[model samples]
Target: MDVTVIWAAIIALGVLLYVVLDGFDLGIGIVFPLFPDEDERDLMMNTVAPVWDGNETWLVLGGAGLFAVFPVVYSTVLSALYLPLVFMLACLIFRGVSFEIRAKANRTKHLWDLAFIGGSTGAAFFQGIALGAFLQGIPMDGGRFAGDAFGWLTPFSLLSGFGLVATYALLGCCWLVAKTEGDLQRRLRKLVWPLTVMLLGFIALVSLWTPLQDPAIAERWFRSGLFWRLAPVPMLVLACAAWMRWAVHARHHRTPFIAAIGLVLLGYAGLLVSLWPYAIPQGLTLWEAAAPRESQMFTLAGAAFILPIILAYTMLGYWVFRGKVRHGDTHHYH
Candidate 1:
């Protein structure tokens, strides 16, 4: 197989992992305002505190893979998204600091809580904006970003931001339903239907908007035989949504979370199918953006060894922290 395709797959896997793993934690922050009770907030934070940082490992891996395997693409995207990217980093830093300091100072806990909410909102919004901008295609001249600093701002990008916020919030709500017990779980159960309905609406909006944004995408999706073959992607996602709604209503603890995760995975797969071969939407192919074969091979060698270790550690962490977080469990990370 070509090294470019190999690295692309690796990068895709890393990205998928990051979105699913870190997504629910970010969602927790998004839904923070819903649970005004300090005890409930603590329990919610406790559910994610141990695994949150570990969940970001895939993000680091994905970024590094992009840099190593597609240096030109990395540079172009960063240049194109300089401001949003910087803001995202700041948001992530603020969010991480809140986790540490919120536990230290009683009086300043409220401030930290605000930071967590703001940071998560900023991070998720900008990420979705970036995704929308990328899908619409970045302006490029000779493989370099040619657009102004505010080129990424558009109506579609803004809508994408809100959509992602809803997606993450849904994931967070489902996660709470799974990990928590008693009144907290019951409250989360009440939220599931609304969040799921909102998510389905966003999915519908994106589904309508995607093909319309680009003729190539429209042709690939609606004008080809592939459309019929790939129709099951959205169908499966809808099924997951239905299953999650039922599971939450039925009070099947783990099933709702699993179904929510499956929904995200299916949505991501659909996006990838719509954007294959192109590294930067309509701008460049994977072969064009990829580093030289020698460079790719060298990085591939290191990634081959390192990725498994990361995967094993991730699995071990989940296993060690397995099972429901009982009410008043002091074993949770503070």
Candidate 2:
């Protein structure tokens, strides 16, 4: 068995879990301004409070796993994208602080609210920028990053940033639909169709624009035999969008969220399809960038042991918190 491939799969799973789990909460912050009432905002915040921090565990796992198993890629990519990564972390810190302190603040509550919104939006935007930069391929020399500090800021990256913001907003809206009721839920449901439309627009733009930016990617999708095999991905995305719209129109709360997740997974799958075999896009293959086989084997054993424990606790947290968050329900934050 290829232990490198195993480790790569593990890390991919971790990243996907992080994006899906944390994306919605960050999205809640993205759409916070739409619902101006303090009580409504509180209810929105409460829906995610118990599990928001926990969702970030996957990010730590993904990052640490990359550093351990693919140190070369980790070092090179981090160095290339240092500025944006730091900005993303700063946003996350402010978002977390605002998450915890927003409930307690009286006079400055609005400030925290703004922080939450700004932090979430900034973090999501930067993440997409980093992704676009990575996808467009990092410049490398002798297995080291050979890119400018501001290379990540580009038209494609900017488009990707806005795309992710819309994606998260849609995810957050679907989540609220399942987790709240009455006027807030109704308003949230109303937002769902438009958010879905907006997300689809961004997805289409990214899908077309990425190929234009990188001819190799275009060749891989078009001239290569890979096109027929990967055809279902876009079809599935359309199906998920249709299902989400129908669910919202039918007033079926949970189905829309499930469909939203389906859309995310399909989009993620398309990305993986676009950049398979290469750990650092056009720069380095996974095998070339991987740590020593012995090191990967050792780390895999530990990850194998720990992954289940993390999965167990995550499942437990969600199960325990399952149910609609009502307006007057007493929360731990209070």
Candidate 3:
């Protein structure tokens, strides 16, 4: 078997899982300001409190897997995007600390709330910026990053940053809709249509903007037979949006969240399609950036054993915590 391809698939899956899993929690922070009622905020935090930290495992997996199997990509990409990545990490740390402390805090709860909002918003925005910068292509010299410190700061990257914030907020809103009840759930459901519209706008902007910014990507999408084959992606996105709207209108609790996930997956697939085979967009291919065969084999063996264990535990956690969160529930994170 081509362990390189296998490893690539593994890393791709890990990153996608990370985005879908942790995206909502970070999103909760983004949407935190909308529902200012202290009890509503408490309930919002409660929906994710059980699974938020656990959801980040995929991130660790993706980052470590890249560092291990594609050190060249890791080093060069990290170097090129160092500032945004550092800011993203700092935001994640602040968000995590605030997530824990906010529950216990009384007067200082408001402060923690602000921290949580800033942290989550900062993290999501920077992540999108990193993604946009990477998509636009990293300057490379002798297999090293050849970009300046501010290379990642661009109009395209800034748009992507805000787009991601919208995406997460929508995701968080859908999650709250599924996991809360009564007035909170009603408010969340009300927010879902507008958030979905905002998210779709961002998706459309990114989709159109990316190809215009990168001729290669433009050609990839429109200049060949690949276009016809890839046509279903956007169609599917619209279908998912329709499904989410219907679910919200019908008051079906779980469907909107599921449909929201579908939208994220489709967007992710489009991105992967755009950047296919390139570890660093317009730079290195996966095979070209791969570590030695023996190292891949060793890591694959370890991943084979560990991934199943992680999957099992993650499934168990969700199953155990399954059900709508209501106010005054004694079983919450607080």
User: What's the TM for model 2?
Assistant: 0.98
User: Model 1 scores what on Cα lDDT?
Assistant: 0.87
Q: How well is each residue in 1-334 modelled by candidate 2, as lDDT tens digits?
A: 9999999999999989988999999999999999999999999999999899999999999999999999998999899899989999999999999988999899999999999999999999999999988998999998888889999999999899899999888888899999999988999999999999999999999999988999888999999899999888888889888898889889997999899999889889999888889998888889999999999999999998999999999999899989999977837535
lDDT of 3: 0.91
Of models 1 and 2, which has the larger lDDT? 2
Model 2 ranges with Cα > 4 A deviation = none
Model 3 residue 286 lDDT? 89
Candidate 3, residue 202: Cα displacement in angstroms equals 1.1
Candidate 1 wrongly placed segments (more than 4 Å): none
Q: lDDT tens digits, residues 187-291, model 1?
A: 898898898889889889998998888898999999989899888887898788889878977889888888888878888888898899899988999999998
Local error of candidate 1 at residue 66 (angstroms): 0.5
lDDT of each: 0.87, 0.92, 0.91
Clashes of 2: 0
What is the lDDT, from 0 to 100, of the residue 290 in candidate 2? Answer: 93
Better of 2 and 3 by lDDT: 2
What's the candidate order when arranged by decreasing lDDT?
2, 3, 1
The residue pairs in collision within model 3 are: none
Model 3 alpha-carbon drift over 4 Å, by segment: 330-332
